[model samples]
Structure formats: structure tokens, C-alpha cells
Target: DAGITQSPRYKITETGRQVTLMCHQTWSHSYMFWYRQDLGHGLRLIYYSAAADITDKGEVPDGYVVSRSKTENFPLTLESATRSQTSVYFCASMGVAGDNEQFFGPGTRLTVL
Candidate 1:
């Protein structure tokens, strides 16, 4: 797995339930990010981690949480899923911010009912 992989390529869940989307990369990149893509919103960041044990919130972190205890994995968890959260989730990674050319994983399409 030299590139990133996202699990549950498609998901359907009820509102108010907890769900987690997995991401894994083998490149050992320093920067990992989670973003949600919607019609008008292009792509909004949900969370990011610079390195193991170093995580931060991005533009749209509400209803979503992320952890990067390992360089190869960055999973996003939805504390309480909502209809508004239904969107395609993409995981990306780069070596650093300035020169980071993001490599995106095949997105996970989530539907909250």
C-alpha cells in the first residue's frame, strides 16, 4: 500500500449513530488530512495531523474527529452522524505543507438517514 486507502467506499447509516471511516497510507507522509466534498463546498477540511500524535482541526471539524497515533493511519470518527454530514470523505497525505502535493484516496460516500 504505497498510496492511501479508504475503507467502506460507500456507507449508509442512521442519524445520531457513531461511525468511523478508516484511512491508511504506506508512504509515511508527515501530513495527513480529511476533507468532505459537497456540491457547492468543493472541499472542506475536517481534520489533519502533521505527524504521529499531532492532530489539528480544519475548516469543518464539527461532528467529526480524527486521530493519528501512527504515521500510516488517520481515521475519522463521527460522534453523532447527521444528514448534513452526508458527503464524500477523502483522505490525503503529503510530506509537508509548503511542498505538499496531496495524494487523495478513493473517497468514501456516506449517507446519513
Candidate 2:
């Protein structure tokens, strides 16, 4: 029984290069979220999708993109990676109604140079 998975738990990239982070959950939850955890700002939402084909921009959507064509998968892409974007990215998912508590994955540490 798999909960959630993230590819390339650690990543290093150069500025202006495109990078993509992958996330997948086996829970088949309806809501999925992407957040970047930094020092001062804390965890800031980047993008989220209510369901497949229904995605919305969150607090820090700039320089990032997300899509959910399937309930079990949500991928985030960095259009042009930047140094300031270096942070730990987390992928979380919640059920439909009961206990809307989010279950977060280990997280992907991203570093931009």
C-alpha cells in the first residue's frame, strides 16, 4: 500500500533552466496541493487542483506551473528556475469531506545555483 511518492527527492539546477517536480499519490484523493517551504515565509502554496482538469493558482504561483490530469498525480514545473526558488517542496492531498487533514509526502529539496 503506497501513500505518496515524489521523484528526485533532491535536485540541483542552474538558473534559467527548466525543472519539473513529480508527485503521485495512491489515495485517489480529490484535492492535491503543492507548497514551497522556506526559512521566513514558511510553507507557501504554489498550486492546487480540486480534481482532474480543475486547477487553481495559489499564493506563489509565479515561476511555477502545475497540472492534474489524474487524481493520483500532480506535477509542478518551474518555468525558469531561479536561485530564490530554492526550497523544500511538499506535496499534500486530502479526502473529499471527512477529516480534511492533509497528508504530506516526505518532500523534495530543490537547490538552484
What are the Cα lDDT values of the candidates? 0.94, 0.94
lDDT of 1 by residue, 22-49 (tens): 9999988999999999999999999999
Q: What is the lDDT of residue 12 in candidate 2?
A: 98
Backbone clashes in candidate 1 total 0
Candidate 2 clash pair list: none
Model 1: per-residue Cα lDDT at residue 16? 98
